[model samples]
Target: MLVDDAVALVPSIPGRRALLGLAGAPAAGKSTLARRLVAGVNDRLGAGTAAYVPMDGFHLSNAQLDRLRLRDRKGAPETFDVDGYVALLGRLRSERTRPVYAPDFDRRLDEPVAAGLVVPAGTALVVTEGNYLADDGPGWGQVRDLLDELWYVETPRRLRERRLLRRHVRGGRTEAEARAFIASSERLNARRVELTRPFCTRVVSPRDP
Candidate 1:
């Protein structure tokens, strides 16, 4: 669906606050679309009408991943604090009288920064984007039930891989290293994300904007 169409539907949802989730494989433009949707909503409605909450913030710390021996598989669903993400979504839904803070992941620091994003009291909609939101595994199963709508962001594999390559290179990896990482890690995660496409409320392409 077109993003403007998606943004227009937010206010009509039957709730004081609505959570719109964007789920997709890495580099599929979920974050980019989430930001655009939030901006579109605020421009059409008003500032503070919508907020963005990213699931990347719930990524396990490098130290934690090292301890768990999952450092090499950073983007995997198992590498995140799924329960923490679930709890934050609950607060964003129920805590309408107070501001809610959520974490954000810094690709430069390669760490999750605490309380990097906030949802103000009375926000009418929250746009959250993540890879595993549609996954039905363990703690991830709770995420779908929390979101009012979950749209899977779809991008051509070639485009996604190209973006991922540039992203990894920008993060300081050599081309060969970036390709290796994608083959060993991101590709596997992308396949896992693909498996959950049938669970999404809709499929949205970044090109739809």
Candidate 2:
């Protein structure tokens, strides 16, 4: 769907603070699309009308992952604080009388920084992007339930993989290390995310923007 069309869909949802979720596999352009949607909404509606909240912020710290022995599967579904994410979403929905702060993931630091984004008290829409929003595993189902709508961002496998490799290399991985990580971790996560496509309200291409 066209991003302008997607932007129009946000305010139409019946709520004081509607949450719009953009879910997809890694490097499928969920983050890009979410930023566009939020910017488009705010430009069309008004400043402070929209905000962005990213799910990457919920990723477990490397130390925590090491303790759990899931460091190797860092991007997997089990590597996030799902319950915390769900609780934050609940607050973003009900507590509209004050600004709500949300965390953000820093790729360079490989850690989640608290209160990196803020949703104003009277904001009309919150655009959140992530890989596992549509996943039904454990605490993930509540994420889908909280959002008024969840749209899957679809990109060709080749393009997605290329982007992932570039992202990893930019984050300090060698080309060989990037490819290995993709093969061992990202590929499996992407496949798992694909299974949740049926749960999305819409499937949108990154090219649509």
Candidate 3:
């Protein structure tokens, strides 16, 4: 599961204004899977036919979080600019418009980079990957109505932890810190994330997919 594509989800993408959602808990392979799906779909559909706009980029800026007094709570659902994510989805779903610009998350900076992304015209599909794409909050409510399909991915809890720990260490955390962070922040979010499972069109567990 650590090194594989969800081929079941690959065939779901279509050529035209299709909005596909990829949802999963932190470090459960959603980003990796989404990337694979995008590549698979693009290869199948040909050039300029597929694009990716992730929900993570819609996260509030560190400065904005400081202003809101929520700096310590980064990555929690409220830490994101939910309305901004919904707005971007709206733009993609619109008809014959100019190429839509999207924000992207910078792992090195731990911040979102705005207008550093573009969905070229004739791009038939937009794949949005995130932890809470299927959340039922008012901010998240706009998604299901907007997207053509939603998929949820699940990794075994232990595997998820191991992958998350590796990511943290690779991104500059000490092994101890990575383990601690997974035990604390990641697990906390995982429980909250389970609340989103029922909302998806399909649930893709590692073995099943």
Better of 2 and 3 by lDDT: 2
Q: Would you list the C-alpha lDDT of every candidate in the order shown?
A: 0.90, 0.88, 0.77
* Position 130, candidate 1: lDDT: 94
Candidate 1: give the clashing pairs: none
Clashes of 1: 0
Instruction: Give the TM-score (vs. native) of candidate 1.
Output: 0.95
Candidate 2 Cα misplacement greater than 4 A, ranges = 1-15
- For all the candidates, what are their Cα RMSDs to the real structure? 1.7, 1.7, 3.8
Candidate 1 structure quality by residue, lDDT tens digits, 151-180: 999999999999999999999899999999
Please give, for residues 4-51, the per-residue lDDT of candidate 3 as tens digits.
232233334343377788888987887777676677666766766667
Q: Looking at model 1, which ten-residue stretch has the lowest summed lDDT? A: 6-15
- Provide the TM-score for each candidate, comma-separated: 0.95, 0.95, 0.86
Regions of candidate 3 where Cα sits further than 4 Å from its true position: 1-16, 205-209
Residue range 1-209, candidate 2, lDDT tens digits: 45566566555444467888999999999888888887777788888888889999999999999999998899898999999999999998877788899999999998999898888888878888899999999989889889989999999999999999999999989999999999999999999999999999999987766
Among these predictions, the greatest lDDT belongs to 1
Worst 10 residues of 3 by lDDT: 2-11
Global fold similarity of model 2 (TM-score): 0.95
